[model samples]
Target chain A: MGPPTLHELFNPVLFYVLLTLGAVGVALASPRKGVSPQIIGGLVVGAAFGGVLVLLGIRGNEAGDLPNLYFYVFALIAILSGLRVITHPKPVYAAIYFILTILSSSAMYLLMQAEFMAFALIIIYAGAILITYLFVIMLATQAPSEEKVASLEGYDSTAREPLTATLAGFALLAVLTGMMAHGMSDLQDSRQVIRPSVHSLEAPILGVLPNKVIREFEQAAVFDHGIAEPTVEEVNDGFDANLRTMAFKIEDRERFDHGLETDTRFRSMLPETIHGDTVLVTLPAERGITNAEGVGFTLIAKHPMALEIAGIILLMAMLGAVVLARKQIELGEDEKAAQLRTLGQGFDDDVAHVGGGM
Target chain B: MITSLAHIAEPVTTVAPDIFGDVGVSLYHYLFVSATLFALGVIGFLTRRNMIVMFLCTEMMFQAAGLALIAFSKYHLNHSGEVFVIFVLTIAAAEAALALALVVLLFRRRETLNAEDWALLRG
Candidate 1:
């Protein structure tokens, strides 16, 4: 779309070609016997090559943005760790590498200003999920007999259909990276005048966001705790146009009732500091609220149903785990006789009755 | 767009100095990172035979998808993406619990962690 300059250094053809080479290297280097030094060497070189390609594609400047080396560093770590996760024969090592990937991606999220989700990822994925995985790996890989020492399974040492799998994976990557290279040009071209994506400062802060959970049968947290307006006006061009048609509560005294056209105008939601005919909403995230609070408020305010469903899901999972892990009951002879007697003529009780009492 | 060597020389650009680089972080950078991570996940999923490792790979893909969602949120300047990530985290936890239980049961039955060994239903 915008001259496709990524092709010059990171052109799809070259990138894919190199990626294919790297993918083949990974597949061929699959753990057989043990991870060969040559395979590790090949993998390191391949990853280093990929990193250099990304570094080459880095563009110099936009406006009001400062790109630092850490983005590149975290990105590389995520990539390399991701690669290590799949290649490592040991499941435990894979899980450890997975932790590195999560941590680095969280760093990437923090860089993008998503502070809440970043830490949440570390807590949930690295803290909870990874621990479960490590436990499972330790449990599942143990030897059944006491005499036989626990050892790696055959599948752990040998990869299944690695060549085809890597090829398929690289093909998908080629298409995606190609899209990122080609499809994102117009956005780059339009970079001369960078517009603020969200007008959080210009928008009115909701009257005071009451920090409390909504009681049952309430209009949700936004009404109970009074979450600020969703900044719909700033993000959506059509919202302001529609607001003009809707009846707004200019004078607070009238009996107010309408659909979204309720008497409460955007101005009513703002603090006393500013006055305006137009309505705008400020994000709690921008208003000095803690990052976690901002995310929780948004969750409670917007996706309360989802939060409830998540809890229900956890409950269901608990039940499912119990059902799956319960020890199987072996029926005793007397119980089997009782069960067989209840089955009537269909099942012979002779087996339970010692040679049919012949 | 004229070709300039200075872009390579200047490590930081003003796209956003505090958050991104000289030409601050764009949607494309995050997209690229996510895509690569996803491909790695997919490759692992396809090639790895250990069930636990395979599950870990799935988590990697989930992370990639979450990264993409957050990047789009930053582009749009919205909170929706982060909200979706919370749900993603929730589902992932449930999935881990169930999957781990299933893996343990299978291993108990076969005394092996290899996925292919449990394929009695192969048609």
Candidate 2:
């Protein structure tokens, strides 16, 4: 028999059962004042998570349809670390776990072939944002005095409303995953199944990148048909006109025309040799559109307004941060007295330093 | 060694579903992960009383949303989803800045990171 489909793999009854188990596990695992049943709860959550993944894997194995092993590994890390991020008692430890979660998420992004976004996630989210979080966590945390055991604050040690939160969260998860598992068949029917073209999504972007195209084709044409490579002198004299003067017949007219309508760059530097089907048509360079270039074009060409808005939003955030940080709030009397004492001590130190200098 | 490395680097050119209605790895797998992450984020945000960690949980939600967007983008064979992730990252950064600044300000006033300290301030 053929393998169990999406519905069978994500059996509603089993899914909900496991989801309930997980929700309970999360509630139990959440940090609490006295002896918390965290380890047992973690085991239950892991078992539940593993049960679903293993079920999916078994069905996937039957169909010979599974993601790369790395996908499973990355997903495991991402989910487990995410759990730890919320469940860990210490705020600093939670932040660290959150970093692990971000790293694994970025790895998953890499697996999904979003190379630009994967690195951007690392750089922006992990590198920049997490550092800010660490800074705030450190700044906000009250330092422990020397005599006492370094204990967690009441808020840090215990979750606020674990049962209600886990129930709400996992119920939403159950609904979402349930929809995805069952509703996929409908989505498949509605979606016009376009034959997956071997040509990449970024293939047309090559036409816009003229200089790279020229550099690539120049060698190929010269090697194959002894077409003269445009000289440095000719390029220096008038690069556009010189490039216009040089053209080659692309063997595949249909494919060239396919990209032609979308790409205006093709219209400007028209291919010189039109009608002949002699040489192979390798006009669009073999090296596909890079992740950065593809994302750059999509950002600049398609969503210029959105990009502008993002910049403005960032600027406003900066201004807002500055305003908030610079605002003076009323200090408690004890803190005000402490501040004054520190200022007085600093003034005395300055006077002592000035006397020493004289 | 080089051949093995090349095998690992083999590119997936397309994601269109095959005869059995499978895109090798079905979109459900990614959606499952994304949903799980997002749910965890919600749980974290709701349960954690540390205001900064609560904000961190919100960041986790943003990360989950970005993952889902990228997955859909891949499923559709489009670049716009990835573009949207860029914007998500931008918003996440802005949020971190403003949220952390607020956290610092609140910490200054109350000298405590507990959310319960400000429970009286409905506004």
Candidate 3:
């Protein structure tokens, strides 16, 4: 009725079949001791991935909801690399493949219009986090000396309970995906349902960031006079159609109005700025809202305490790491007594020498 | 003045479409990706005997969670989801620091990175 839901589009039986195939493939691909059929397993997994994606595509087309072709590309890369991350025998190679997974998923984030987070994922996860992983992997694993260089450690070459683990993991996946498909609705009107609250919180951020507003207005060349600084105030009484009372607080509304009156085209572009009782100054549609600005505002305004807690957690982690990793030199009981006697003798000698010199 | 000010109080119903152009990917699609990634992480964690690789699997799980958060953020047209992801990243970074340090310490003592070496002590 309302744009066909994923429940309607996705066939459960076919999905389970593909999922089971994937589980078998993963088990076969997992690192094993001798004559591991990794190539066949990889092919099987690839086949399963292809089948599931193709099924989704066909169903989506039937429902007249064309899937984003790029989603398929990024999703394939991400999942395959993710599989490699777990299946690869060598730790260094596995870490490298995980980087590939991070990169492709970040690309998906870019596709989702979350540009700030996409780049952050690349910089933080791929750049910082994966580098740490590689360092630890290298640090922990011993490279075999010249003669036996090709042989990998026993633990590195084989997986523990690969079949059982794969079975359990796929079962979990089946349940999660099945529930998501069934329980979730394609709420096309959810935007309208949530937008009012989001807008109320988002608009005040412009008030705090007056420079941003001024920059946009300057770029538009709509205002001749230097716009006055906006005064943002929190409204105490919180119940109305719009919960936040002071949605936008432009102190110099008269000048703003005069400028708007002069430029009809610009004014029309910014229809939300003019209302009966509130002088809300929102960014023009052309300028739009940047991802970083929205994320920053939400972090500071709504979840300041959480942000602070995160900082504290990081600091504690740093301290804990230093304490945990530092090599502590322990002395035997006899060694400690001897060392203390030597230290005392040395201090006495130094004092005597100083007193004689004086 | 009152008429213009009244515009400020008007509820904004249309917020996401104009900015993103169209709702291209369905919520279920991203959820599927997230679920698969998470499940793989679980399998990797359970199967891998190498301690570092096990920790790496946990990091993958964190990445999966972050992906889901971003997707939900886009779906709801809310930045709070993205904000939560930043926190998730912070927690992940913290986890990596502590876990790696413990790994290094363990490796120093036993000269091995196999998780099974510590399993008896853990029990």
lDDT of 1 by residue, A150-209 (tens): 445555766677778878887898787776666555545443333332321222122123
Of all native A–B interface contacts, model 3 reproduces a fraction of 0.48
Alpha-carbon lDDT of model 2: 0.70
How do the residues B71-119 of candidate 2 rate in per-residue lDDT, one tens digit apiece? 8777655567889999999999999999999888877765677787665
Task: For residues A129-203, write the lDDT of model 3, one tens digit per residue.
Answer: 889989988877765355434443666788899988999999999988876665555345556576555544324
**How far off is each candidate at the interface, as Cα RMSD in Å?**
11.4, 10.9, 10.0
**Candidate lDDT (C-alpha), each:** 0.62, 0.70, 0.70
Listed in order, each prediction's TM-score against the native is 0.71, 0.74, 0.77
Model 2 segments beyond 4 Å from truth? A1-6, A144-152, A193-203, A207-209, A212-280, A283-285, A328-358, B1-25
Tens digits of per-residue lDDT for model 3 on B48-115? Answer: 98888898889889889998888878777677778888888788889998989888777765667877
Ranking by DockQ: 3, 2, 1
lDDT for residue B34 in candidate 2, whole number 0-100:
91
Restricted to chain B, the TM-score per model reads 0.79, 0.79, 0.79
Interface quality of candidate 1 as DockQ? 0.27
Q: Model 1 in CAPRI terms: which quality?
A: acceptable
Which regions of candidate 3 fall more than 4 Å away from where they truly are? Answer: A3-7, A143-152, A186-196, A199-275, A278-283, A328-358, B1-25
